[model samples]
Target chain A: MIRIANGQGFWGDSVDAPGRLVEEGPLDYLTLDYLAEVTMSIMQKLRRRDPAAGYATDFVDLVKTLLPRLVEKNIRVVANAGGVNPQSCRAALRAVARAAGFGGLKIGVVSGDDIFDRLGEILDAGCPLANMEDGRPLSEVSERVLSANVYLSSYPIAEALAGGAQIVLTGRSTDPGLVLGPMIHEFGWERQDWDRLAGGTVAGHIVECGAQCSGGNFTRWWEVEGWDHLGYPVVEADPDGSFIVTKHEGTGGMVTEETIAEQLVYEMGNPRRYVTPDVVADFTSVHLERCGPDRVRVSGARGAPPTDTYKVSISYLDGFKAVGQVTIAGPHAIAKARVCAEALWGRLRRAGFTYQETLTELVGLDSCHGTIPQPPSHLNEVVLRVGVKDRDRAKVDRFGKEIAPLVTSGPPGVTGFAGGRPKATEVVSFWPALIPKELVRTTVTVEKAAG
Target chain B: MRRVPLSRIAHARSGDKGTGSNVGLIAADDRGYEILLARATAEKVKAHFGGIVRGVVERYEAPNLRALNFILHDSLGGGGSASLRTDAQGKTHALALLMMEIEIPDDYQTPYPEGSPSKGPPAEGLSAPRRKSR
Candidate 1:
């Protein structure tokens, strides 16, 4: 049996969680998932600006805080904080470990997802980096691309673990890979163990967000107890691939059927066809039971083979956009908000500030559902959120200027327009495409820094 | 791009509020999504193109459904000026479709992977020393 704990849910999760995880209990492995889809692009921008700035600096700080306990507790660490730059990320972590006087920490890095340098080569090879949506090519806004990373799986992570590294870092791997990698390590689970791999993937999904499964974002949040000190999730895994999902006892948050259901529903697609880099888990086969306080036994996950091509996360230039809002109050507030929206768009059109797309909605009034939903008859107050998007920066900028004028010109019940003119913000877009796994090679290397 | 599991975000019905709706741009990862908050309009725009393209932008809302698939159609802009598609072009189209933005927490930082040397000694009592044989 392996006691695995998820310390950090994302890059910016609670700073003290990782350290607390090691200090508080018996944990075999400490896994952190920092990379998100958009995070890769941001990291790319940072890497371009400063060679060493691309990795998760927070991870270094967290490592610095937890190194002693990590070493003392025999807690192995794994994370995909590598974003677009794994080598740089590893070097930063090495520096942090050295500063802590812990020389020779075996840190492993998994990379090769950053295909930026080979963009043209791949295109020349006929990959066409076409937009999964509109079929647009990258040449449209290639210059504006801040970052490009392919979704990698747990194979590299397993290699790193097998290579005897104490800490393993990765660029853009699937979230489940973080948890699945460790399971692969302890149980010697083979890559072809589809059922076992799927089990790990399901377990990873359950604990990916730490406390989220333990009731962090419950809609019936009021019913939850001790949320202030919510306990992160822990996975007790067996060689058979079945695991128990629970949180540290004496911690805040509720581990009930409702909470589990909420998380189960999160990011879920086809209950039977949930695909990841490792396996396609079937949620329908999953069975959950509350065996004890804060302990939910999760088992019985089914899975199948993964897609031949890895889905890539591509973010490029979309368009410029800006939004501004105002609260409408007093008699016929809904009416006033609608008028404000119409007037704002009308005014923009009259000013020749036609955006490729423009929108105006009254938060509490109009159903805001594409069509002007019938506002509640008694809605005396509503927030008019108006925004626009266009390939032209000037148009979006102009859209921002129009919002403030509405407070004085559009209608009587306008008020929430505190943040001056909505600034023209660059639109970072997403492109999901498929690439043969062979085309994206992941390399795992372990390094030891001098103290 | 983060794909919002339809089951999770099916409850996310934002259009009723006004002119634009909060469409979840599901990515392979959650990389720039936080920044998407400030750039929500881009996500919204991407959502608008979901139906027009030949493909699909997965969006499903059912009690039994677990994820939303925003099946994107042909918004990749007809493969751009060159018939050949570059990785950048695909990513650009994904971003172009974004319309709604949500603010990521201020503490958000990007994480990356690193390579470590193999000659390091093991910790005193925690894990066993590196095994030479597999």
Candidate 2:
């Protein structure tokens, strides 16, 4: 039996949590998730200037902080911190390990998800890279794409583990696959055990979001206590592929059936058809019970065959957008804010500065109005936020410039528009599509740094 | 298609028959779901059935938990004993029909994001309970 613990759901999670998870509990493997859709683009921008800057730098510092304890305790680490730049991530991790006096650590890197250099080649080879959302081909924004990654599964990670890697770093893998890979390694589970494989996938999903399953975002949250120091979830896996999801004893968070249930429904779409690269688990087949304090036994999860295709997250340049807000105060503030926003758009439209998508929101007035069914009607102040997105940056910039003018010309109560115009920023849009698993190949390499 | 809750499904009693398993369907959410599950679990179910299930397709409804169930024939590759994924479409169909039978609770609500294609729909039905944010 092996105990696997996940310390991060995404980049920018609690810095001390991973170290705390290892120090406070007994764990064989530790995993962290540190990448997101827009994060790739941000890292790409960072990499353009510095060759060693594309990966998750936060993870390097984290490793340096936890290396001593990890080596002392014998806990293996796996993470997808190698965003867009695996080699750099490897180099950085090695540097950290060496600096921490751990010179013989072998770091494994999983690569080949990056298709940035081959975008035109793929398109030229008759792969349109069609947008699954609108069915538009990749030719639409091939030139504007910052990053394109095919989400890989846990197999490559298992290979890394077999290769004697003390730490495994990956780029653009399914979040759940990180935890599932460790389980496959610990249990010696075969690839054909779809039932057991699906069980691991279910466990991954339950704890993928870090503290979320423990008490980070429960709807019945008031029932929980000591959330100020809520502990993240840790999984204890047995040889038979069964596991118990729990947290450190005396931790602040609550792990009950309701907490797990709420986490299960946090961002759910279809209850019965939960899709992952490993298997499509039947959420209904899952059973959760509070066996003891800080421990919940999750078992009996049923799974079906996995889909033939994997979802690809492609973020491309949609357009440019800029938003500017001005606070309107005093009597008739709401009306004044409305007129100010309209006057800016009217002037921009008259100046031939049109946008593909334009929006105006009265933040203090009715931001969550329509959805909540009852939005406040009376308000003494309102913040007028006007934004525009278009292929033309000048047009979006023009829309931004029009907001501050309301203070002097359009509305009497306009104030707090001292920042001038909001800068025109590139709009990143998501494209969800599927590619046959066979078409993509992931490779893993174990590298050691030199002095 | 039937709909059931996790709470209701937990109370369900599962029976085994010499490695072959039998459990009544209490509720199912949609027809496509059973298809999804069958695609993932055809081999395992076949192993449990001790081979292929080739007779009639049986169906039952659990309004309380909202599920359905079906039983298949000798579909397991090794004479209803081995669990392999290379099953025939008929066997896959029978397995898809079988998943609809698990009983779900009346209050079974979805517990995670379903990774849908559409973007910008604030995940509904969550009321933010005020507590110190962690």
Candidate 3:
């Protein structure tokens, strides 16, 4: 059996968590997940500004911090911090490792998930790239697209491990792919081993969010202890594809059936067919029980081969958007907030700029659940949040300028304006679609840093 | 029949995809599941959400787990980075569903061992308890 732990759930997760994972206990492979759909466009924009600035710089720095411990323990790392540019991320890590005297470090860089430049060609070649939400073709928003990536599987990552890479980095890999890759490399699991592959996918799904399975953001938050030092999750895999979910010994996170169950159904749809590039994992087939304190045993996962197409996350520059808010307090809070919003919209329109979309909400009173069935009479304060989105940047920008005047011109009891005017920002939207398996190819190259 | 919020007997979790969102409501036990199967239909869920959801609602029954999954199309204004709302991903959407008042048969007892709504909605300032991740 091998022990795998996920330290970083997302790119912006606490940096200290990874170091804590290393210092706390024994781990064979440590995985980190970094990319989100819109993050691809953000990284692409950075790359456009500077070729070397696309990937997560925090990860590069963390590697420098972890080099000594990683070398002493011989622990391999798998991370998808590559964002839109795995090659650049590999170079940055190589430079850092070479300087830090880790000359023998064998780094694996996986690429080809990025298809930003080739999207136009693909669309021109009869690929509709239809939006998964609606059947609209990608061509409608093709000109505004920023970055396009195909979610890759575990094959390239496993190949990297087989090539003796101590650290594997990939661009746009599936979250569970980071875990599935190590399992494949360690146990030599075949592509056709659908059940085991399914098991591995489930294992990855549980730990992919790091501290989530380890007692963070649990629904029954009152039952969980050690909130100050929440430990990330680790999975123990056997030859039969079953695994035990646990955190490091003596760590501060609870691993109970409830916690595991919560993570099992999170951000999922159609429980029976949780599709990935690897296999179709049956979320309902899996069994969960509290085997021990801070430990849960997971087994009996069913699986099937994946579909013929690969899901692509395409991000585009939708439009410009801006939101600004001010607090209105003392009697008639909801009414006053609404009045402030109406005044702001009037000001924006009078300036000869109408937005494509506008939204107004009394945040404290009815923002989340929609219009309240009944409003409390004693309500004291509420924030007035108003926003606008438009293809014309000037309109969104002009909308931001209308907030502060509401304090004096519109309603009374208006406060909460510590920050300057909210500025217009580009809104990057996601367009998820699929392409045939034959249209994309992934490659992994393993090499040592040159001093 | 007495009217009470669904949270009296069930727990829920929600998430988003593009403009859509899904809520998974799990009954506390066998009795709760039977009650849920009878009352928590897709049309009812759509009605509960009303204008908050912009498209059709789809339901999947998980009898083995005593859970019902409801997909609310166009639930998120635009979802993810595209959405301008505070809860763009609909992380708190399940709580909104839990606040729904439902009809129960006479002599119905909540399966939840903790403080449950045998009478009406959960107390004010009471957060819809459960977990959110992913």
Candidate 4:
């Protein structure tokens, strides 16, 4: 069995979790997932400002901290921290390794997931590049498109591992691919091994969120112990397409069948068809059993062939938005909060600065779950949060200025506006499209750090 | 029959999918699964959400996990970075769903009994006051 642990759930996950996984356990591979749907756009913006500033810099520091141990333990690392630029990420890692005295470190770079520059050529070649959700053509927002990347399969990562690279960095690969890649390389699983691929995919999904399946954000929060030091998940995958989800011994958090079940259905669409670039996994066919404390054995994952196309995540400049909030205290907090919101909007409208979209929420009352008919009587305080989105940055900015004035001008007992006026931030919207699998070609290259 | 909140026999997790959000409800036992299968229909879930979910609610069943997943379309004001609401990702929709009350037999055994510490104190004024039968 090969032990693979996912430490980072997203771009801004716990920094200490990855190092903790290496220090606390016997692990063969450490996988870190850094890219989210909208992360590429942010990276693209950064690259435009400074060429070397795009990739996840946190990863460089992480490798620098764990380089000596990683070499000694022979633990291979796989991560999609490349963002929009895997080569730059690899260069940064090489510099870190050389500085840390691990000059012989081999880092593999996976490219071709990013298709931002080739958007026009691909679109003109009869691929409409239409939005998957609304069926809108790319022409509508093509000019505003900042970054476009295809979600590559696990094959590129496996190729990197097979080529003897100790660390593999990829751009825009699927989150689960980070785990499944090591499973394929260690077990020598064939390309058409549908059942095993599905099993590995299921295992990847369970632990993709790091500690989500190991007590973090669990529904039964009271049952899980040791919130201060929760354990990130590790998958003991075998050749026969079954795996055990467990954390390091004596670690915080509990791994039960229920925790596994909750993560199984997380962000799931059709249970019978969980599609990835590698294979179509049947989440309904998965079987979970509690083997021991902090261990859940998962098996019976069935699979079918994947689709002919790969889903591409594209982001564009939608508009600008700003949100501002103020606390309303005293006996009629909810009522006063409502008045504050209405007056702010009234002021904005009178200035002829109507926005494309606006939202007013009484946070302590029903902002989250919507307007519940009977909010508790005699609430002490409610935060009045007002937000506005518009194509015009000035309009969104004007809406922000109205929020703080409510303290002295609008209502009684208005405070907590110490942050001053909110500034308009660019709204980077997601546009998902499908590209023919053959259209996107991925390549893997391995290089050693120069002394 | 006695009416109790669904939290007595189930747990849930929710996250965003585009402009929509998915809530996966897992039962405590086979008996609770049966109760969920019967009572947790798409129509009822849509009605329970009120104006929060502006679009349709689609439900999918996974008996292997004793879970039912509901997809709430067009629910997040716009979802992701485009959304103006605080809970743009619909993260709290799971607990909001657990707040739904259901009817079960008086002798039904719940994993979380009414006064059990695991169930914790009842949420303030979530449910209507019980009326004494004449």
Tens-digit lDDT track of model 4 for A41-64 = 999999999988789989999999
- Fraction of native contacts, model 2: 0.00
DockQ, candidate no. 1: 0.03
Q: Please list the residue runs of candidate 2 whose C-alpha ends up more than 4 Å from where it truly belongs after superposition.
A: A124-126, A369-371, A410-413, A418-420, B1-134
TM-score of chain A of each: 0.92, 0.93, 0.97, 0.99
Q: Alpha carbon lDDT of residue A294, candidate 2?
A: 76
The numbered model that scores best in DockQ is: 4
Instruction: Estimate the overall C-alpha local distance difference test score of candidate 2.
Output: 0.67
The per-model lDDT (C-alpha) reads 0.66, 0.67, 0.85, 0.90
Per-prediction DockQ comes to 0.03, 0.02, 0.33, 0.59
Which of the numbered candidates is closest to the native, going by highest lDDT? 4
State what share of the real interface contacts each candidate retains: 0.01, 0.00, 0.32, 0.72
TM, every model:
0.75, 0.75, 0.94, 0.97
Between the candidate structures 1 and 2, which one is better when assessed by lDDT? 2
**Preferred candidate (lDDT higher): 1 or 3:** 3
Candidate 3: regions farther than 4 A off: A372-374, B104-109, B113-134
Instruction: Count clashing pairs, candidate 1.
Output: 100
Instruction: Estimate how well candidate 2 is docked, as a DockQ score.
Output: 0.02
What lDDT tens digits, residue by residue, belong to model 2 across residues A189-286? 78677778777887787788899889875533445778777888998876565678899887888887656654554334345667877778776677
Between prediction 2 and prediction 4, the one with superior TM-score is: 4
- lDDT of candidate 2 over B1-134, digit per residue (tens): 34532222221222221112233333224432343334324344344333234332223322223333333332221111112112212222322333333333345443322323242224443464544423
